[model samples]
Target chain A: MDSEYKKEDFLLLFGSRIDIIRRKKGYSYERIAQGCNIDGSDISKISKGRVNITLSSILELSKGLDIHPKELFDFEIEA
Target chain B: MDSEYKKEDFLLLFGSRIDIIRRKKGYSYERIAQGCNIDGSDISKISKGRVNITLSSILELSKGLDIHPKELFDFEIEA
Candidate 1:
């Protein structure tokens, strides 16, 4: 369904924000993964836009990074 | 650059939100495109996760939809 496409898009966006916040917080992939209970390799892949992550993982990452989940999408790229 | 991947992820997430809001508002792709001054085909591609859009386009789409730009990233997909 078309909705599936939309879901994928959302995941990609959310994943990117997670990567930005991680770097901004000065946390490495392993640190974030250990803190968030997610796989470090998956974090690396997600940061590189090679993997899609779940909403639960996003929440965990948010908690780990001390950022509001919404802040991830707050800044926009110029394109 | 890694930043490029993050940017792409943001665009994808923003685009997905546009698609969800458009459907919720009962608007067609063409209608949103016409109102937002973006190419309809681009809207279609963006919605389908095939195209990356600029932040300006996201703002225009938000204006056309009467939805807060932040709302697009408000809801998280289950993954």
Candidate 2:
């Protein structure tokens, strides 16, 4: 993560969005990661905003989650 | 952008992906920005990976582009 990028900024925001989408789709991180051929720990990290994902991973996760990657940013969190 | 995120890495990668998607859908940045209600400059920055966008903007752009956000990351660029 960039020192300029507060963990609270992108991570929490990204995590919350991922959480909402995952719940809406009824998918576990493990299941989604498996389908996307990525590690479950990585997915967990992503959902928690601990990792910054590549565009490719984002696409794979979307496919696994059955959501538009844009939905990952649908919710707003106050800074 | 994160110092950890090399401009050449994410920017080029994201840019190429966006370029591919935009071309595939025949969308100009102006049209997408207008549809998404974001600044055209901002959209240009994003396509070039010069700025790190919020999840909300990502969602909006996806809607405007008529693409699953995941498709934005479908292309791979060599680091």
Candidate 3:
């Protein structure tokens, strides 16, 4: 289904999906942040839909999770 | 190999990949932007490595390109 998303909806869905992926990989936000060398607070914000997550951020997050970057997009994300 | 990237290298690679995808889809920057309801100038800038492209932006771009978001990460991106 082609769903139109506002930036807010998009961010919310992205955060939820990232949260799911982090949990599935058995990583705490702090651990993943450490792996990514990003701030833990920033990771928490990203997971809570409080920031505009960049492509580089996704790549770093996937790297931290030890998964293909594409795997991050492999789910249905609800707004 | 785990490629540790600077933000600049990351942006360049992301732009290159986006350009490759846009071309593979036979889309001009204008048309895809139209489809995504985004600014054409911004799309052009994105392809030029001038933006810190967001996850939501990628989703909209994939929608515009009529491809899976995962497809955007299908190739190896060089710095």
Name the top DockQ candidate. Answer: 3
Write model 1 residue lDDT over B1-79, tens digit each, in one string. 1111243454466567778888899988878766666777877887766654543455556555665446756755332
**Residue-level lDDT tens digits of model 2 in B37-75:** 567777788778675654455556665676655555555
Deviation (Å) of B13 in candidate 1: 4.7
Cα deviation in Å at residue B46, candidate 3?
1.2
> Which regions in candidate 1 have their CA more than 4 angstroms from the true location?
A1-69, A72-79, B1-13, B77-79
Candidate 3 docking category?
A: medium
Could you tell me which residue pairs clash in candidate 1?
A13-B9
Number of the top lDDT candidate: 3
For model 3, how does the per-residue alpha-carbon lDDT over A1-79 read when each residue is reduced to its tens digit? 2647566866777678888988887888888877786678888898888888787787788767767677667766442
Query: What is the full ranking by lDDT, best candidate first?
Result: 3, 2, 1
RMSD of 3: 2.9
Q: Write the per-residue lDDT of candidate 3 for residues B1-79, one digit (tens) a residue.
A: 1647566766777678889988887899888877786688998888788888887788888777777777777766442
lDDT of 1 by residue, A5-43 (tens): 243454466567777778778998888766566678887
Docking class for candidate 1: incorrect
Specify the poorest-scoring 10-residue window by lDDT in model 2 chain B.
B1-10
- Model 2 RMSD in Å is 9.8
Better of 1 and 3 by lDDT: 3
